[model samples]
Target: MTLDARSLIKAYFAEGTLPGLPDGHFIGGRIVANSDGDRLESYDPGNGQAFARFGAGKGEDVSRAVEAAQQGLAAWRDTPPATRCQVLNRAAALIRERSDYFAVVEAVDSGKTLAEARGDARSCIRLFEYYAGIADKLEGRSIPLGSGLTSWTEREPVGITAQIIPWNYPSSTFVRGVAPALAAGCAVVAKPAETTPFTALLLAQWLHEAGVPAGAVNVVTGLGSDAGAPLVRHPSIAHVTFTGSVATGVGVMQAVAPNVTQLTLELGGKSPLVALADCDVDKAVEGALWAIFSNAGQICSAGSRLVVERSIHAEMMEKLVARTRTLKLGHGLKDPDVGAINSRQHLDRIARHVEAARGRGCSILTGGSATHDPASNSGWFFEPTIIDNLAPSDPAIQQEIFGPVLSVQVVDGEEEALAMANATEFALVAGIYTGDIGKALRLARSIDAGQVTINDYWAGGIEVPFGGNRKSGFGREKGIEGIDAYVRTKAITIRH
Candidate 1:
């Protein structure tokens, strides 16, 4: 028997350590190498230790990814909708089966608590299931063009999509955004936030095991300048879907402009939660606190702006301040209530907002400093803070802080509250807590947002079409409308 020396050594020692698996890189498709292929280390915000190193791409790699995506398009589009649904459902099931593993990886890498990470994992699975159920229901409507030869509309998949996710909710965003694109039969190249790529990498592995075709989905873990810019500017990429800061979204839009690519941007917001005088002050306070501090106020649609009627403003502010004082901030793993800040940069941003608000004469009702516990000193963390007596034009009311900070503004009446809420540049989401049905309906209809809740505060779910007007960016994700973002409509006419 003639055996190569390399093969013999591999058989002997590979099991132990010799040929270690690659740390992290592209998945589900062929990776086209570029000269600028660099490595970036993802650090745990809690411990500041490098947990994983992922590949960073350059300009040329984008072209290669686009080509690979084009190649996969035919196979993915030709796949029966039912089969695609089955594959997606299988991935969802696998997510549930290995929920704990993903939760641990997410907590260590992203600085979320195990419980919150588990919830994020479960939400990802539910997102996949939701989109999978709608795979067969995506249809183009029949256009009733009065002067047309009998017109029937067909929805056709766009060729290739470039989707960029943010670090705050990387897992949920990836699953929510990608599942709909796949269900619509479009191939995708995903650019997860560089800070949290481990969970996304693991998700790609599960997708392969779930029987998703190779090259149908790809992940490039890298910096925006290298990987993201290339993906956006690639000529073959038909669409761009992004969820991040407004500044980044603007850059993406500029890059894709040359190609005339369809774009969907779910960007930043300073959403408002209004409390009418007729509403219960305690209930409003509880709802407002959860809205502002859930997920550390990292959500785009979170009601960070509290616009309350002046009649009950003092009482409501007292209750809100009391609640804020009760919040505990520490290492996510060690605490059951609040988690560590997402990163050091985020902590700095929150501090700046507090300083600026104080400079502008806003009162710090309660909670303004980071936790000083020796055990959690290593983690980037901050307390849930409340600031009252701010004008509508205050920076805290206009800009998205993306942290656990809420600013309270007093309004004279219903009309003034509505005016203040509509003053922000973003129209992603707003909430109204009112007892009067007429007032609730009026506010809901008048608010300049994609979705409004009369008494609730949840957005970006499976059933609702979530997007924004004005600068909040266009295109809906989730629901039947989400499928429309990945496909184009064509009218077909036949005459005998």
Candidate 2:
């Protein structure tokens, strides 16, 4: 069913705030009805038209949020693991109940295709469910110490955490960042990117209905400087989890210094997808296109660099260009496929990268531009771009463009392919496309990335941990390892 603008807005906010949720409360549990009233408009990326407006808050807002989180932390921590699991299970149910509204809000707010937005909204439900199952399963081992002393270890919440999520994958990233922290008994003050706060706020409303303690999960919407920084720098915050650009991550790291708070940063990537000669060229091209253009390549682990063996580079490039040209770019709210960029700034950034690559002798195969049609350019939209023949060392190749532009290069052999893949300093993820299982496994192990995929370019499910090895930043975001990221191991000993 096609959702018009009026119907979409009605579906999200409905007649008013989510039923039974406090009129003006932070997701983390603060009541701010009289607190300085301010709001920001969320726009439709397809046409730059405003769809909805969310409240804007500052230090006063931060204090209210932290207080609410602080108030609820002890009870939540003391709650039975089984109880927490039940709460999360119900939260997942509530989210699923409202998935359509979330999909609509997410699609318009972030310019993601409606189908993609629905997938993300569903993924959010899965994340909550997955973490719910693991909530009661967080266990620590008993370490043997030879003596009359008895010793064991317990994994405890590290107190309140301030999670700052990015614009891309708003539903997935926000929940993925928040759910595990909640499962581990930590209250969260999440600051989602200003441009895409609707889904996060909607999730917050769902959590409230699911019986999460009033302040267990708080979301404050505003600029990163005011809202994001305050949350990170707050003295009461025990941990800071962030997902965004390397530049911003570095800044956050610097700001949180002296406090020595625990940090889990999932930063930028210029991930490479290496296609071996023996792999199917058509399939490899398809995989590469999806890897780089999904969410318009705003993903941190986008395989933006395509490294093909020289023996098949030319043929693969032909297939890649042809496949890319077939991708439809238009209003995600109405399209069956690829949609607009998240914002004007993102579209400009993609354009600049393509221009730079062209100036440096790279050839445009297809889709290297943007359009201003109301249906397509109302939001941040860039065409799926492909720049071939760029040197592996070229600035456009090494640096992250964070757009729909794909840079292709040729390598002489398997060794050369591995070498070229490692050329980029940012090593978040790498994929190997090869018919030989041994070669694929070998390269997967040897690649300097936090996660590597063999024969496929997609990052797998929640059971698999995802992060980076080098400057792509530290800390795992999924799987059992993610639980470890949210807690501190405490060893207690008693002499008998």
Candidate 3:
């Protein structure tokens, strides 16, 4: 049976309401509605229709959650690593069993297609499984001291953690930090992005079912100011992991400063994609599309800035435009090539960027307007836009539009291309496409981004460290290095 907008809508409503914080925050292994009775409504971005209403958690709610996490931590800190591994593995199995349902919920909540949502669900399961596999392997070393003295170092949990996940890829992002922290024997008070909290709440339930002790994992849902700020400011929170825009990340840093908290931030990016004349134009085009167009270009590490050698610039642009035109746009459930923007506000922001670019005399090669499917006339949508005749320093190029807008710049040669690609204030992920492997590797080494891909857009796997440099923010997530963020080193010395 095909799942389209109407059918999904019917299924969603037939259940009476969307599945999420039906009562309130998930705290101490139970759902607790806010005492103040504040609430927020969640909408389906594919259409401007309200689907679910949940408690808008406040500072008091966050405080309660933190207290719960502290109590839970006291209990969980003594849990054997082997037991934690077993619980995480069980959670991973449960997530895999209900992957389809979670995917549907994600698609409705975040305005991403079913295909993308399913991929995120799978990634979430993998993260839990990966952390589970590594739980028992968090080994410490013994350092030999002179004479009868003995010394050793051990990795210990950083205590209760405050995990702030972004709206995009909510399920996967939630697990990315939470899994490692749990494996490290730390309890967590997670704040899911206000716009998309359904899957996170559901996951919390699954965690409890998987045998995670009461208060070990909690979800507090509300506006950032109401719930998020207080959670960050809580004195008991020993660590924080945030994923979002740079501006917001700075705010998080400020909030956590008073507590002297350990932090890991995955901020925004204005990544570049460099296509040399010697590269395969077909592969470059494919990579470019996957990098920027996937997820409606809302990705932080999107390859929005396309730097091409002047010789093949015209040919590349032609192919990019032709392929972009063929992309289908519709509600996420319909599985269109492109889906609605996350919200009306975000859709307008994309338009403003395009208009600003046009005002500066940049040429719009194909699309630069809001569009909609006849089936769902109320959704927020934007055309896949390609802007040319813009310099590398153009606002449209320098800033993160966070939409399906690609800025094209032609360069004289390799040096110019490198200079242009590295000119951004943000450095997260960059890509280089060239037939010369030696040249590609050389350029990759010089790129200012944290992760560079050659001939492809996204490099590495779930086990590879992923983060950024400069204004893109600090610290890393994923791989073995990712788990390190949740742990602290303690050296013990004994005199015998």
Candidate 4:
């Protein structure tokens, strides 16, 4: 709660409710705003007001960014691996220096609470640090093919990479993709989600100050059709890492198809949190609350589905509801327990999902409607909701709601719980809260998610590899495997 709040907030609101906003695409280290007259206005969801005007990029802007990255590729890739890592270490230090300001901007643009945004800023710093530490450790292996010939593999940079960041996690996603790509010595052309574009551009500028060449990192902000699509399709972009909806991810897949660009997509999730009868009920309730309520449940891996054992069903609901009802709501600047929804359209989407579930005879446990922040009374604020009495066939249980909604499904035992959990189309992350480690391991093996957590909702930090299966999209990000998308292995043999 003790951030540099007063002065930062005062400075942010100086330009008529807008912060020191960056208003143009950052290409070759320069801010280009006047090249295209089309502009996009960014609104602060906390106040439901337009506070920024930036460029609305077209295919042409994406082309310029691609050219800049191509020019920056050789110098970056040829630099000693250790030197490349030192730049990220410097960037991490810069992030720590600017953490307070970055957190404030992130909270404003993404509609997450200031506390949550601060956590994200810390996560960003750790992401860069983690990748930087491992840059030199990314080694190629030698294969023995008899004594006469020496054979070894070289891990080389995958040239220019295209990153399409999402609105939910603006800053962290930008760092998450860019950090690893740069560590792999690949120049990057990134397009931040139009809704939350400012922080990424600012981060790009900071990277230059941290010694990354200006052309080595470019941020183009615009609509997905206008800028994102073009960046994905550019032939020079050797790898593309995107995080967003399944529908949009599918489009990215197709766009990269003609060029056959290598892709890494971290998409949607209807992730489950399974609470078995033998689990510690108190811990299960705590995990359920954090999983569905954190960041207003906007994360790709948010445990939105609660699969509870039949014996503990009533007790679990009682505790979950009591804790959920106590959650506070206010503007993100105020750092309440729950903050504003990202946009009116997303708010409407959340409302429609709840209405559809209620219509299908699902029982509402506590909250099932939208409520405004009592303080500001302007932005869209949905009460943290918990829906119960879900039928197995309920769309509410199957689809990714991507909001502050947790739907509960009661199961007789572990067998039924596993079956019900895997019933969804997504396989992102799963949490199993049980005292029995052997039982948890057995259940984990059976779950289809990319990552599984035992006892906690968000169990790992930046070091864990994360992604999803089935409709959640493919390829991995974070940890050692994260750099895989930005690098390719070349096998070389020497004959004596």
Candidate 5:
């Protein structure tokens, strides 16, 4: 059931439109038109013009996707582990070969710069390859037994699992969840974020082409209420892996409470980038700039809060502000250093936070307002902003402003800097820049984040486990630890 996906992918990017896009759900190993005739138009974030219309899945469609997954679970779960791993390898190869095509479409679809989108596509490929190695190694342990008794364990799939994705970095996030789930032999019902379903659907199709059984991979796209909620609440779903806002994660928890289904949530964060007095100013400046500005600062683990020691604060601020002002903003297709925000609403959200900071008498060191492309004058764009003032309680410092904005807060010493870093309720990932190994280790251990880095912001990839601490959400994703949520252990014993 291989699709002419290459042609479809090529056609859209070539023409800069989606009229030829598959306007349907990818179910039962192929494209499926919606049960109802309702459709929703997707806009190009670069220009804010409607580019394509896709099917709007309702509750019934969600049921259909679940049913399809249930039908395929047995065969997929029972397949030899080596064969399963091979299929994953093949899928990764396919994506890697067409990586450029994916990059262009991702940039256009998600309003990310071409360079950023390429990194995301590459992340997806590497994640698939990393998970493929673990498929055949899901082994259990033999227990010590006395005399005539023998005991051991077996890891078994948890039937149908639902993976709800987020719009930002959709391609990478989709593979992050699904690759591990599939490697563990679980059939999946995937709900890509409504606005960014293109890459996920195309990736699912490639999985099918790589020998996944029809229905083993399903994607239902539409509004969250219509498709995502129903999929989350679907009683038959054995496990759920969701990535989004904390408020929505709570709703998902309440929905799955009655079923007692297992859940893994990766909620957003207001993560910190702490620079100590001993840290290299150049490295700290570069790390801070990248940690907040990449992906237009839409990443859940973005270093939105910059906590700096008072002694080096002014010097570091001068250097950071100098570089940040030089960043170029334009359409994603143009591969600018910074691209458009995902939507007008998101632009407004970024603006409100900046305006609130100004109202609080914070010094707007650089950008502090929403502006359009200086050339086209169209699209949702926000100037890269840096706000500096007092108070750890400022909303701009405390909240996850998923935009290209950095709140630079000055702290007295190491203790105050670390205190401010952990003051926020959200603890996902944090970065501490310092020259002292002892100090780095101490701060890394003291930070409340699930993962911490010294001198670098994003130092790890698919190899290390990542998640969050406290309100940032929990359950690890990536690495071998990621597959645990998709399977259950069964103990067996024999007595003679």
Candidate 6:
């Protein structure tokens, strides 16, 4: 019999006595049920079906996980760097071995295409492997002091770290934060987004199989207000790393303030993609499509604002609208070009933005509504939308829509394009596409984003640093800088 998404899902679940759902938080070493015995159902964004349930982590659960992390920190901190590298490498291997299963779970949980979910799994593996290679290389420096005195600095783990992951890219986001913390010899209390916690639970099992010490990495699943708030406020948590909206990130920062907890925030962005008249129009169009429509445009650094030179603005708009119309929309399991939005609430949010843009007299060039497939009628799907004739100050142009929506703005020249790109408060990412290498490089420099792509979007691999500037929040992830976020420096002095 031929295999479809439903068949594949059923077969995967039927193959073994895998980790059961309605899981409690992964504390100390094993799955521990919530003390209050509360449960939260996880829905499939592809069909709006509740496929699994998990114990809703609460303040009590956060406390228990924190206690476990606090108790386990010493052993993890004392573990040799070589051994830590070995463990992280093993975890990477395990993730690769179960890549198919993890990919399916991520697709079913997050509504991203199976291919995208597989990419997420691969990214998770690469993150661990990258951190493993660098685990032993986190060296300190020798400082020059008086002639008779010798001084040196050493990097050490910052104790228990609390990571609050978002649902957009659950598996990769979870590992991206946890791997570096573990590599840096810090215990982690990870809280995956409640909407997509299953893969995180499965990842916890893989970590255990990879010989991670119990309590060294824990998974807590619950609402942000309930479990996340308490974890951020918990005095025992040494550091906090959060990825979400600006409002919630602010709440996290505020909660951690009483204790002055060290923190890293990767908030939202209204990234810009500029297409110059000198660029290959086809290549620019492709880059713009991938930049905005990948993962249904839910990425934090998605190039949602399209700025094209006035000379080629009309041609570029026609090309973008035509290409967007050809994109297939369906459930993620089917590997459609555009998959369902992450959830009902998110779909509603996107709808509100589109409606507001229309109300403001912004022209909807094409696709300003939702579409549904008969096979997955319950899915929360939004059409790929292109809006034009909006001022730079328009809310739809300035705010983070976090959906498959692209706002096009015409500019007279490169200088004006750069000005419009940086006009927003967000400075997470920006992209420039031009055949003139010198002009591309110059435009890249002029853009005020933490990460800039020239002639392409998302140009770098996992080895490069990624974060944001201005309102996009601080602290870097995904490079040597990622590791530094989990560590602190101490100076040692010796007198002869």
The better-scoring model by lDDT among 2 and 6 is: 6
- Check candidate 1 and list the clashing pairs: 28-215
Tell how far residue 478 is off in model 6, in angstroms.
0.7
Let me know the TM-score candidate 6 reaches against the reference structure: 0.96
Q: Model 5: runs farther than 4 Å from truth?
A: 1-14, 18-20
Which regions of candidate 1 deviate over 4 angstroms? 1-22, 29-37, 140-151, 371-374
lDDT of 1 at 227: 81
How does model 4 score by TM-score? 0.97
Q: Residue 447 of candidate 3: its Cα lDDT?
A: 90
How do the residues 189-267 of candidate 3 rate in per-residue lDDT, one tens digit apiece? 9999988988888888899889888999999999998999999989999999999998999999998887799889899
Candidate 6: lDDT of 384?
Answer: 94
Indicate which candidate wins on TM-score.
Answer: 4
Tens digit of per-residue lDDT, candidate 2, span 1-496:
2444447655544442222222343645544542577777767777777765667777788888898899778778888999989999998888777676667667777888888888897888888999999899888788788889789989899999998989998879988878899899998888889888767777887787787888888888788987888889999999999999888999989988979988999998999999999998888988998999888888899989999888898888777787887877777656645878888888887888888777767788887777654443345667788888778678878889988888888888899898899998898999989999988888988889999998778858877898996789999988878877788989998888
Report the candidate with higher TM-score, 1 versus 4.
Answer: 4
lDDT of 5: 0.89
TM-score of each: 0.91, 0.94, 0.97, 0.97, 0.97, 0.96
TM-score of 1: 0.91
**Where is model 3 more than 4 Å wrong at Cα?**
1-10, 13-21
lDDT for 434 in candidate 5 is 94
Q: What are the clashing pairs of model 4?
A: none
Ten-residue segment with the worst summed lDDT in candidate 5? 1-10
> Clash number for model 1?
1
> By TM-score, how accurate is candidate 3?
0.97
Off by over 4 Å in 6: 1-7, 10-22
Determine which window of 10 residues in candidate 3 has minimal summed lDDT: 1-10
